[model samples]
Target chain A: TQLLEQSPQFLSIQEGENLTVYCNSSSVFSSLQWYRQEPGEGPVLLVTVVTGGEVKKLKRLTFQFGDARKDSSLHITAAQPGDTGLYLCGGGGSNYKLTFGKGTLLTVNP
Target chain B: EPEVTQTPSHQVTQMGQEVILRCVPISNHLYFYWYRQILGQKVEFLVSFYNNEISEKSEIFDDQFSVERPDGSNFTLKIRSTKLEDSAMYFCASSPIPGYTFGSGTRLTVV
Candidate 1:
């Protein structure tokens, strides 16, 4: 089974602070996606990294895929209270299934 | 932006009863998926549907679970004889390829 392991299951930070969450797996994936979910809501896609060592940034958020496609990272710069939510990483393999990580609960206090 | 729509945001049903969750994927998307997340647990993939048939399913998707794209836009997931353990937030997703767009989800509470 391909499993994605996320680090720092829980995080608490003040507004304007910076934080980074990591996702790692022993198996390689064709693509990796990051999602942010609020309470009582489904996950919303943030970004998808398809190529190895690729980095994509969206405003204050930055996502990076490992050179081997076995790991990924999400970095938030100048975090805000609105950014507080559950961050998830999903790995898409050769098949149609997507294996999701346990997720990191982020709390950005204003 | 197009979105995947799921019906019945919340459902409470007795154990051993049958329940069907519905979804309307994006008009142009070809792939559909079902996933569930128990409280405080990770999101788990249940099944994937493509071309009016199931392409992949996880171990958690057993005989009790079935999926159908009966019409042009509607996708449904039927859970026959639901157990208390089946209670969770079920999310429906659609994608053109690997990247998915998920619905708001239906919170299924099997009592």
Candidate 2:
């Protein structure tokens, strides 16, 4: 089974602080997707990285895919209270299914 | 932007009862999927549908679970006999290829 392990399951920080969450897997995937979910809502897609060693930035959030396609990371700069949510990483393989990480619950205090 | 829409945001049912969750995917998208997230757990893929048939299903999707695209736009998941373990947030998603757009989700609580 393909498994994605996420580190630091929980994180709390003051507003404006920066934090990074990591996702690691032993299996290689065709693509890696990052999603953020709020309470009582489904996950909203944040970004998808397909190329090895590729990095994509969305305003304050940055996402990177490992060169081996076995790992990924999400970095948030100057986090705001509105940025607090559960972040999930999903690995897509040739089978067209996504294997997801347990997720990192981030809290940004105002 | 087009969005995936799901009906009955919250559903409560007794164990062993039947429940059908409904979704309307984007008009132009060809891929539809169902995923669930237990309380404080990771999102798990349940099934994928394409061309009016199931493309893939996880082990978690058993005989009691079935999916259908009754109409060109409506995709539905039916649980013939729900167990307490079935309680979770069920999300429906549609994709053109590269990315997926997910619905707000339906919270199913099997009591």
Candidate 3:
């Protein structure tokens, strides 16, 4: 079984602060995705990084896939209250299933 | 933007009763999946379906759990017998490629 471990399970910062969350795994992945979930709602896809060393930016959120495809990172620039939520990183391997990380709970206080 | 939809936003069932959770995936998507998240816990995969069959399933998806694409659009997850540990938020998701769209989810409570 492959496991994806995320660092700093919980984070709290001021509205204008920046933060980064990391997801790491020993097994290589075919693709990786980032999602943000709010209270009482399902996860919303934020971005998908398919290729090794690929980077995608969505407004203030930046996502990066590791060169080995075994890890990923999500960086939020000047986060806002709206960005507060649980951030999850999922990895897809040879199988059609997605292995999800424990997730990082972020709270952006205004 | 199309999204996945799940029915019975919340369900309360007896410990030994059966429960069926329904979902309508994004119209054009072909793959479907079920995941569960216990309160304050990580989301864990249950099963994945494609071409009317299960492509993959986790250990957590034991003998009591089953999935079916019965028709053209709806996907369902059936639990033959509920247990106290079954209380969690069940999410239905679909993906045509690697990016998935998940439904609002159904909170299942085994009383």
Candidate 4:
């Protein structure tokens, strides 16, 4: 089975600080997506990257897909209290199933 | 934006009792999935349904667990007999192909 390994299981930073979360895998995927989940809520899609070496931005957040389609990253700039949540990275493989990572719990204190 | 909806935000059931979780996926999406997350853990895939039939299921989805798309809009998951270990947040999701939209989830507590 393919597994997406996420690093920095937990992160805590003050407002305006920048942080980056990473997800790596050995198997290639057709698409990679980033999601943010708040307490008592489901994951909300942030961005979807299909092509290799692609970058997509949403406001102060940036998402990048690796050149091999086996990894992805999420970078947050000027983080705010609202940015505190669990960040998950999932990739759709050949079977079209999204294998989600363990997630990075980020806390941006004000 | 359109989103998936689930019923019973939270439920408490006795162990060995039957439980059913319901969901209404996005109107236009064709693929549906069920996922579970234990407290302080990552989400785990339970089952995927397409065309009113199951396409894939995880080992965690054992004989006691079943999925059904009784109507065009509603997808359901049933556990024949609940267990203490079954307590978790159950999420339902739908996607046309690539992007999946998940529901707020139902918190099941089996005691």
| Top-DockQ candidate index | 3
Tell me the tens digit of each residue's lDDT in model 4 across A3-91: 99998999999999999999999999999989999999999988899999999999999999999999999999999999999999988
Stretches off by above 4 angstroms in model 3 are none
User: Model 2 residue B72 lDDT?
Assistant: 87
Q: Report how closely model 1 matches the true complex, as a DockQ value.
A: 0.83
Clashes in model 4: which pairs? none
Error of 4 at A73 (Å): 0.5
Per-model TM-score on C-alpha atoms:
0.98, 0.98, 0.98, 0.97
What does the lDDT read for residue B30 in candidate 1? 88
DockQ score, prediction 3: 0.85
Q: Rate the local accuracy (lDDT) of all candidates.
A: 0.95, 0.93, 0.93, 0.93
Candidate 2 residue A50 Cα shift, in angstroms, is 0.3
Residue A4 of candidate 1: its Cα lDDT?
98
Q: Which candidate is the best by lDDT?
A: 1
TM-score of 4: 0.97
For A6-100, candidate 3 gives per-residue lDDT tens digits of 98899999999989999999999999989999988999999989899999999998999999999999999999999989999999965458899
lDDT of 2 by residue, A1-110 (tens): 99999988999999999999999999999999999999999888899999999999999999999999999999999999999999999999654678999999999999
**Which ten-residue region of model 2 chain B has the weakest summed lDDT?**
B93-102
What is the DockQ score of candidate 2, to 2 decimals?
0.73
Which parts of model 2 are misplaced by more than 4 Å? Answer: none
Model 1 residue A54 CA deviation (Å) reads 0.2
